[model samples]
Target: MRPVDGMRVDVLEYCRVLASQLRLAGLPESRVRVVVQDVLAHVEATGEDPVEAFGQPTDYAAQWARPPGVLRVLGLMVATAVAFPGFWLVLTAFTSPVPWGGAVRVTPFLVSAVAGAAVVGGVYPWTVGLWLERRAGRRVGRGRSPLDAVVAVLTWAVLIVLTLVVVQRVLGPDGDGRTLFSVPRRVLLAVGHGGMALSFVLPSPGVQTMPRSPADHRSWWARVRSLLAGTGNRRRF
Candidate 1:
């Protein structure tokens, strides 16, 4: 691999470590993801190693750690480990046997569930562990520390299995008590395909958020009027 590619991979690995440490310190996953994105951008822009640029993960995590009390810590732990993952799995279960206009065949049970998860990942990417982590981060209190994300993954592995079960149950053959099961799964597929399509059409997220040039900061009306005045001046000359 090229040197830059190697650095990028190392940086990505470091980001995972930083994220874990940050979560252990109690930062929510959304904040951690954003922080990681920012770190990536910074590293790419500066062409520097993350550790050299940002310091060690442990020390960096400390910067974002929330003030700890027993109550808040405990509450956040439950929220991350249980409530967050539980809701998503239930939602995932609801989405099953995603239709694809017969483009891709979905087998029953294991194949169906795996296909459903992949569909969710391919188009919508909602099944992504990182994205889901960010979603869980939404439940965190603004006042709480960000390291709670560490506890966030505590139950995800198991929850993913449960999600598979739910998808199976939801996708069980119709004309049985399973009629309502397909509704959620269809929605999941719809969302997945729709999101994937939209991704291609939309501008890149980084570019959308990129800082404007200093000159672009001029008031828009002022800019227009100035342009007009300049045009008239050139014409007169």
Candidate 2:
């Protein structure tokens, strides 16, 4: 085999080992796929040695096996904090127009209690969690862990409680019908998630999860800068 072919094999072997270790560690299959996705993206982006860039497969998986990073977990929690309230406020638009809105009006103390409960909740409510939820599952039977259940329960509970509080505060004790109607929040969320889940039910004709690695995957701002930088051709014209 050629030198490039050997390198490619080595990378694939490394990915396999990493995936096996994570699965053995009881990390969910979806989460394991994400780790592989990240590794492949990094490898393709910068042709650095996989071992050099990110140690061994078992070591990387071990870190995930261990408790999450303190600050990183806290940051995810903060995102969930903002997102939960935002989702509720979005829902208030619908609930406000209907009757029996007064009963749903959450007292300030109840708001504080629910937020506090969510703060103590053990959940990864940010990017990773969102990614896992969106990924379509093809298999018919899969047993979920209690931790996954806890995370999901805490997530929904937080959103529901947060909605009540924001709805009451903004729309008043008896919610006014006037609100943002351009988008129906609940229906949008349901349809979007449902479609995403349904996509995985049957084999897709020509869809691959992660296709060829892009030459550049920089942020929008970075791309904008490059686009704005003229190559002196504009002056020539």
C-alpha TM-scores of all predictions: 0.29, 0.30
The sequence of per-residue lDDT tens digits that candidate 2 reaches over residues 1-237 is: 022333433566566656655653456666777787788779889987676677665566777775235575455455444433333443443454444323233344434434443443324333335323322111101222456557666666666567567656664553333333234445534543443344334222112232212333556675567558853223211
Candidate 1 — worst ten consecutive residues by lDDT sum? 203-212
Backbone clash tally for model 1? Answer: 15
Residue 200 miss distance in model 1 (angstroms): 27
Tens-digit lDDT string for candidate 1 (1-237) = 022333333565556656655654556655776677777789889888776677655456567885234564444333333222223333453444445432222345434444444433332222233333333232221212355444334444445566666667766653333223233454445654554454443321011121223224457586568668875233211
Model 1, 152: alpha-carbon shift in Å? Answer: 16
lDDT of each candidate versus the true structure: 0.46, 0.47
List all candidate RMSDs to the true structure.
Answer: 14.4, 14.5
Stretches off by above 4 angstroms in model 1 are 1-9, 24-30, 67-69, 77-237
The best candidate in terms of lDDT: 2
lDDT agreement of model 1 with the native = 0.46
